[model samples]
Target: MGRTNGGGGGSSPSSDSSRKFMEFAERNARLAGRLADLKVGSAELFLQTTEQTRMALCISDPNKPDCPIVYCNQAFVELTGYQRDDIVGQNCRFLQGRGTKPEAVSKLRQAVETEEYTVVDILNYRKDGTAFWNAVHVGPIYHEDGSIAYFFGSQWDITELLAARETIVENERIATELRHRTDNLFAVLAAIVRLSAKDTDDAAELSEKIERRIEALAGAHRMSLTGEGLAEDKSNLRTLVESVLRPYRNSHADRLEIEGGAFDLSRKNITPLGLTLHELATNALKYGALSTVDGKVRVDWKETEQFVEIHWIENLGSASERLDTHPPTQGSGSGSRLINGVVRGTGGSISTDYRPDGLQATIRLPIKNKVSF
Candidate 1:
């Protein structure tokens, strides 16, 4: 009876051991099934998030030949004007067009080959053949083994932003140009007022002189700014000179002689040239050649390939007797300084000669190529 009881005890222990083993196995199986469900749910959530995002997203399979696109979200389709079916299984380079920069393409290509992240502002075309600037961000999606699984690209249409930036730059440029022009105009006016005050203490006389000088400046400004009905945005040298001297020519046409072939002067140089000529003529009428009858002023110009040389000569005739009175002090006055400043601004040079006969001036200015405003 003792042996049989012992054998029964042994059998009961073996059965208990087997039962515990089965229970452990069952617990492990249930845990595994729960873990699998969790993984599937996570993947589905990721896919949903990507699909719903506004950012244009696309996935290219590197394992596939040529790394063609395998997945693209709805936003990508809308941005590129391509259907999902048409986009899938094609390389992303199809978006490139003639305007696309080769440097950008090379950078993108290198990034993909080396599994590096990169961003570029590249020109791209849509399915409808319209061009747009695309700011693209691309990087590698790696697998758990630290190997590249896919290349992920996100793109944004930055065409409008780029256009706005360009417009701002252009506006700033125009503002700068206008400010420069205003400053130059004001400088010339101030010089005129200061110099005119020195010549005469009479307010009426100074006023008349200032008015006439201002009118000459205004004429030049009008011609330079408006082109004076010329098709091009430039003035003819002869035309500008004749117009500036027109006031002096009215009373004595024989006293002023203008001789020059047609040479184009850029609008930028017109006002300065006009101002210089006006100062010279005013001096002549006051104390030089134009102070007496039979005094003659001859203006002429010659042009070379790169420079236009202007000559202004005066014959004092009977007025030569008064040469010692003024002594050709043209280069030592405020008017002379103004002339120098404006001429130098145009990249030109001027020289004055005080002879026993009269005053002579020579100006050489560069002929700049025509540019569109």
Candidate 2:
């Protein structure tokens, strides 16, 4: 026996789906190319297509008073939370508020007056008084008579895009700071180790010396990173030298003497000068004035209009009791190369003469800018 269903039958759902697909295909064939290629061939369908798009689009009459908006898409209404009737006759400037930049507004005004194409990003407000960044593009539409009939304008709410850009910039800044910190870490470690290894053969003695030099470098590194203490004031030219030599002073305090007038150094010059000065004191401790009780070291500087000269001299005994009679052809080890780098890096020249009395080194650097006297 056959059984019958209770509901009455209607057209199959597949038939309805087919009809809708055919309708879409027919409409799509009418607008087969890009909008620019079609050129508003079907004005009503073109306007309807723009209304369906997500981007806010509008049309304004150039011939009308105040160039009022004559048409606006559904997306524009949705984005601004404004009714279609309320927006059709108003100027787009209604979206602007106190937060809008006057420069951007002026540019928009000029573009409209000149009937030229322009794109600008401006701060705008919604109907609910909420702010957003809007990127707007506007261009003139010409009629068959070669006269401007309407202005076509499109806009995008770019608030999220601007926020994303700001986040990327902030991340880049943080990455750069981290890179500098890493570089400073390795530089401090390498400098102290190289300087300490030069003076001794005994492992224990070398270790002790390395530890002390590392401590000094750590102090300088802290100052450099935190911009504290002497490092905060770049105007003090002799601060780096004083810090490097402070540990080498004896109980009598006559072993080191500094005689330089107050002057400022640039930030780029500070680290190089600090490292170079540290290396110099290390050398003095090994063989020069600081090695002997009676020996004394004098560091003096003089400034001219175009140059600054620094003199490092070790006064060791009288001329009759001098240790070395002739200057060495070259300085020893990587210390010499490091000092050379510092001199060359700063666009300066250096010379060393091992006189019968003591070792004399002179560095002449061009005056970049003298912050103080």
Candidate 3:
């Protein structure tokens, strides 16, 4: 809605506020001549109409040395907390102070230099030095000779609007994070159940195995979520491998061996890789070397120019025969596909070799230069 004002031009008092505007064509003969070239009409009641407008308006002379303000309406004076005498002949940049953005200033400069229109949201200070967000629109008015005559500027205080928008964006981000965490929780649980079911036929045994796997997965998930791998205490390759094999090393200290240089893994990849390692260890405990008292498994990894190669060799130097070899079962194939899918999804590959000595597996994944966690 717009404000009403008494006027001398018409008896109706221009009640149609939407039609009220600054009549640039009738102010000066030079301006009137310029507006004629643009096919714009004259406004006899310019001051009366523009005085009631809420929007701030100013006109500057581009032909001047510094593009100083020549005319400013009542709204512009009220908005800046400045009187007509203090602001006239001064550059509009006097409103800019400490917190103004340099990039936004650069954009405004480019627009004005090229005599093109531009809109920018910038921080400006009132005469009292109080800060406010101003959405400013500026454009050039051309003379009949195709030369730039004056630069017109309009402004609106949008501090509250911007604050509201930021609040909504933050709320949406929090909601999205909550949804992702809940989904990950369910996914990790389902994976544990699927992999544990393959290792046992008895219900009790499956339950016990799932409980242990869940404990390991929970620890890894907790660490991954703590600071998204950016903090100083972020989990790395060493911690990830240890978390997966912690449950398997209860009584046999010498059964598992890990050798790898530490590096950061994104939170997104931690769970998938952790589950893959858990699956491999579970398979060894069921039918491979881990089934025997003297069995041993050595896990080693090294980084290359473009990839990281990880090797899992069971009973590497032992004389134990490959036990309970029933050509790849349905359960084993499912586990293989799950592990393969995880590796492939991360732009990697996995291969399993069943030799007489033991099961040798190799996983190769590309080394991403940077990871977002």
Model 3 per-residue lDDT tens digits across residues 272-331: 677678878887787776777688888888888877777888883464665555223123
lDDT tens per residue, model 2, 1-373? 0001112222121344345445545665565666547566678777779988999998887666667788999999988889999899887888899999989888887776655678999998999999999999987665433455677888899999999999898778667655754675576567557754775678898787667546655655554454443333343567766776777765427778998878765544455556566666777766666666587888888887876787888877543255542322145555666566656656776788777667788876667732210
CA lDDT of 77 in candidate 1?
97
For candidate 1, lDDT tens digit of each residue in 1-373? 0011111111221343345435545765786688687776755866898889999999887766677888999999999999999999888888999999989888888777655678999999999999999999987665433445677899999999999999898778767656766787888888879877876889998899789878888888787766554234477888889988998999869999998777878777788888889878888887778887789899999988877888989899876754656632375675677677778778887898878788899987778833211
Q: What TM-score should be assigned to candidate 2?
A: 0.49
> Runs in model 2 with CA error above 4 Å?
1-117, 121-134, 141-146, 150-167, 173-199, 228-269, 284-330, 341-350, 353-373
Q: 139, model 3: CA deviation in Å? A: 3.6
lDDT of 1: 0.78
Candidate that would win on lDDT: 1
Deviating ranges (above 4 Å) for candidate 3: 1-23, 26-61, 66-107, 113-116, 122-134, 140-167, 170-200, 229-235, 248-257, 284-309, 320-338, 341-348, 355-358, 364-373
- The lDDT of each candidate is 0.78, 0.67, 0.70
Q: Evaluate residue 245 in candidate 2 and report its C-alpha lDDT on the 0 to 100 scale.
A: 73
**Backbone collision tally, model 1:** 0
- When sorted by TM-score, best at the front, the candidate numbers are 1, 3, 2
Runs in model 1 deviating more than 4 A are 1-43, 219-270, 277-335, 352-362, 365-373
